[model samples]
Target: MATTTAPTTESLSDAVRRQSMAEAHTIQAMVDYRDAEMARTALIESSLRRKIERSAIALTIGEATGMSEARIQLRLSIADRVRDKTPQVWEAFVDGIIDFSRVRDISATIEKLHREESVARLENRVVGYAADHTGTELRQWLRRFVQRVEADLAVERADAARKDRHVAVAHGDDSMSWLNAYLPSHEAAAIEARLRKEARKPADPDDDRTVAQREADLLVGWCTDSDAATSAIDANIAVTVGADVLAGATPGFAESTDGCWAVPAPWLADVVATGGTFWHRIVVDPVSDDVLAHEYVGRFAPDTLAVALQFLHGVCQAPGCMVPAERCDLDHRIPHPAGPTTGDNMGPLCRRHHNLKGHGLLHWSTSPPAELIVIELYPPTPAVEMEYVAA
Candidate 1:
């Protein structure tokens, strides 16, 4: 009988290597599939919102169609980060153009280190420890190690598609704005259904005062004090300008005293409450009944006032244009309405747009919209060009 020879050591080693490679490939494939699915689902969701009866139903469709809000968010974040990078870089990495072992080594390095500082320290430590282990010199090894770390992270990210754990609640009227997230399908459904019902409910008085009316009354009581009017004419009307200007320039001379503008009691007609802040509707002269600029007051630090302005503007101040609010600043066109150092009549304006306002080169037609203060700007050499429109 012929004796069966055992497999050679080289053959066994080759088999193990092939098995590991196959496993990694399988993981990578799964990751790719999930990523594609997430992108498709997001697109589908966007289109569906235009035709759907309610926004909640759209979310239900997403859940029923095998897409999770968490996964969608994860995919979006990953796409955003890598979107700026050259597509070729990501493509080569994803397609395994580079060695898988090198990719794995890079991933391990990146995962072990917490921050950039930590990574630098580790690189130094690794170079010293593996002084003789690697064939390449220390400097070369360090460079390779860092490259591997970044490559490894990319590979791992490709494999790690986000898991479906929640559903996102978006604005019904505006499908673009995300409102909140929901854990369970039933909860989302119930909330959406209830909102629709409430919206459809007929205007009928059941009690003495509505919730809105009661809240309005409470606000009126808080803001419009009876004794405030008498005290304002008789005693000094107190106005809190920025502490810096009050301390630095004129300590005792109040803004309400003479030449400087002071916010009158009656000018604060209707206290518009929005987003944990109060915007006072102040009329410049009560006799002429001419309304001046609407002032927004917040409890946040004065320097961080840009945040509030951005929130108000929602986008670029330029009318009918849709530039993002992120790149805008609170530019006081005609300086502070109250003549304070900060945050009186500032609106979110782009740099070029702000310069136009500051140089007095821009002409703004002030008009109050129902819910917002609309400013229409006209630049010189105008073909009726609209400059900046603030809310």
Candidate 2:
């Protein structure tokens, strides 16, 4: 009988090396091809020259590569931008520690950032981080990084984008319909968070609906019936901003603890000043990431220690987890009876991570405390207008 066996270790090693080499070569070839097409296009500078909108070069590459024109364009863009913005990321790709999939994602993120310096700083950080983390983890980190760095510009962009807020319904087969809402990130996050929270509450044992079904039902009920599922409408989320900025003494951005969105400082100040029940004050040390002070009352109050931990951590302590700290378990680092439940001894871990930690499968280090990986931001200088003197 003929039997098939796995390849030998040496053959397997050679195959892996060959695969990596091929991937690197493929990316390099694409870059060179795009450059050649661009150079060819540049030489035809007559009045009959094609407009940039005419993607003739892309079509030619698409036909050759058997990829869609749009796909080819996107791949070429990723190759070009990754090489230009962060040579380290390109090197990492060539080294085969990371692949083109990651390069495409990273390039898309960096494109959102307008400032050259911010792009360079982020590129430096993500190159090393991407080599270790999964795509989902990289995504969470990018969202937080971009939001924190472009805090001021983000506010403006959000304001502008709000004008385009909309909802649409698409009819489907079997009398079904698809509904979508294009909304501000914070508002959408809050709505979904609320639905998720409500859906998880203890329900009737006889109820056959899954969590998603429950959430959908609740959402429809709230939208169609004014009195439906109305225990509380406002979702509890965290926002951190500086008091100096709130008072208009200095400029800064208000960051959501969930890392989903950021807005101008004024929104937080308005919420707090207008007696927003859920909004509380917490003074944090930016340099050392210490929660120096806090204020709260009644329904807005949680355990003082818990609040401090949430403010300190902002997200789950598990590497790359994006679950907001407020929603996580306040786990003791050294365990309960042996470890005092102080700020230094406690941190937030999501349910899954908490289980892993409990089972001794996971470990956390406290060497570099605080979420403060200091990124120095350079503010744009004011443009000075010259006075025209009679000469």
Candidate 3:
């Protein structure tokens, strides 16, 4: 029998690097082709409408590149911005540290801010972040970053969008339909919270419906009633906003307790119009709405330590896992008797990862008190890959 060797983790990591490098070179070629097309057509197509000229070029590139013209346009847009604005990020792309998605997401968000200083700040700060995180997470952070820096814009945008809120029904394949509502963030949060709270309550002993089914039933039952507005369900809003926001300064947004959603800073008035109060909990990771993410590196700190951990490690420590820290086991990076039970040695690992650690399949290595606790697993990340907690 012939024996074959399985590829090692190091080889897989190297393969990913090679693939990203190939993609980066390909994107650069696409960008060069677009520029060449524009220059070639400039003199002859000067009399033609700009959109028409671009469409022809886009179509030609699309045929040769096997990408749709629309998609080609988007790639060109992002590439142009990256090449013009953020040299560090562009260098990362060329070196295979980040890819086209990183450039795309960062450039798209960069288009939102009007201030030169803010754009420069984002360009300087985002390369490290975009490299370390997934696209979804980068998008979320970029949005929150936008809100922090351009609070007025975010608030005004939210206000403008709220005026267009309405309910619509879409007929589905079956006999049923889908109901969708476009409400302000806070109101939507309240509705969701109340439904979840209600669903968790005791139902009939014989009822086998899940909490989700219960929520759906309750939603229908309440809306079906003549006095739907006066339904018995109640929801408590647990929100946190910056001191600057409450003072009418646009520094950051008001967010829910679990960091799920954020409303504009000025909307705090609406939240507390009748009279409500706020308190500060020292989660040891208190984030200012206005500060950059890298500034708040974790150094062992408070919230009774447990609640602090909840706020500290927002997600599972396992590589690329998305499980929320609240749903994870408070795991010691170093085994007990060797590692203390303090925050320094402990972080959040979901059950699956924690089990892997028990079997010696996973490992976590910490740097100094101020550095990230890097995880060593399949497709090993750099030991310098410490996590961050900016808020």
Candidate 4:
């Protein structure tokens, strides 16, 4: 038998690998270009919105309508954001391609039209209308179009209300505590029996009911007679990690898969150092187990975590605040024990920034593995003195 050939650098595999690497680089460059372009567009649009607020209101009949300057400013603000999509669809409304009786938010309608149809259709409609309509006439027609859209939306809301009912039940005590009393045991038992009957039925392929709806209905039955397995789910986990890849880089927090976003372990030096940091609590979606929002409580340790606070937050990260890292908290950009605790995923936050992040006033959106750079400063403060001095 002939000896089997061993792979060598000269084989076709080397060429294919080089080509794949080239393609990946090209794709990354394109993504970077697109992001830069989006940033530029956003800046331009912001400037235009400010200009419209200053000038557009002057053209409107505000005094007769009793619309305050602030109200006019607000409308223009909304208009400016929607202008790009609105102008393109203005002709569609005038020509009756879009049913004015059913549409709302002309900008949103235009966007849908373009996406559902084609850019060619949008371009053609605008060109055809531009030849016949004046800018002032177009604006007037759009105002009426918006009114029809609102009426249609109201009809939709009413229809949905007739289809599904939302019942809010108050659950008292901590989340880990057993389900609170709602109605009498007999009433609860009756509801549970009905839920089981629905759960037992085979799934209907043609049924309009969503998977979420089916799961929700099943969940009602699950609430009855809790077991060890059910109790384990009741204890949600939380974890803290840094925003950067390396540990102790940028502090942040995220909830664990279980939906519990715990405070960083007090034993972790970073957690103990940030005096102003606190336990940010949140009730997550039971099904998705995603955090909804943070409810903050002061729970920081003034020692131990000092070095981590210094490392992650050189200063306060809030937009306008300028507090130092020493006074800040070690915030898990993603939070821990509840979520992944990585070095680069952390952020240092002063009291002001901590409040902002907890309240959703300021948000931390992460990028992919390599380009996870912070746009805003963490613990916005003056540069700290380097710990080691050259001899």
What tens-digit string does per-residue lDDT give for candidate 2 at 217-266?
89888888855466654446666655555556655556667545656666
Superposed by TM-score, candidate 3 places the C-alpha of residue 220 at a distance from the truth, in angstroms, of 1.5
For candidate 1, give the lDDT of residue 189.
32
C-alpha RMSD of candidate 3: 19.6
| Pairs in clash, predicted candidate 2 | none
Regions of model 1 farther than 4 Å from truth? 1-304, 337-344, 368-371, 379-391
Best by lDDT: 3
Q: lDDT of candidate 3 vs native?
A: 0.71
RMSD of each: 25.8, 18.4, 19.6, 26.4
| Per-candidate TM-score against the hidden true structure | 0.21, 0.63, 0.64, 0.20
Q: How do all the candidates rank in terms of lDDT, highest first?
A: 3, 2, 4, 1
lDDT of 3 by residue, 64-183 (tens): 889998988888788888888777888888898887777788888778888888888897889888888888888878887888788878777788888999999999987988999998
2 or 4, greater by TM-score: 2
> Model 4 shows how many backbone clashes?
54
TM-score ranking from best to worst? Answer: 3, 2, 1, 4
TM-score of 2: 0.63
lDDT of 1 by residue, 294-357 (tens): 3343222143466766776778675564666668755654443322224435566677766766
lDDT values, one for every candidate: 0.41, 0.67, 0.71, 0.42
TM-score of 4: 0.20
State the local distance difference test value for candidate 1: 0.41
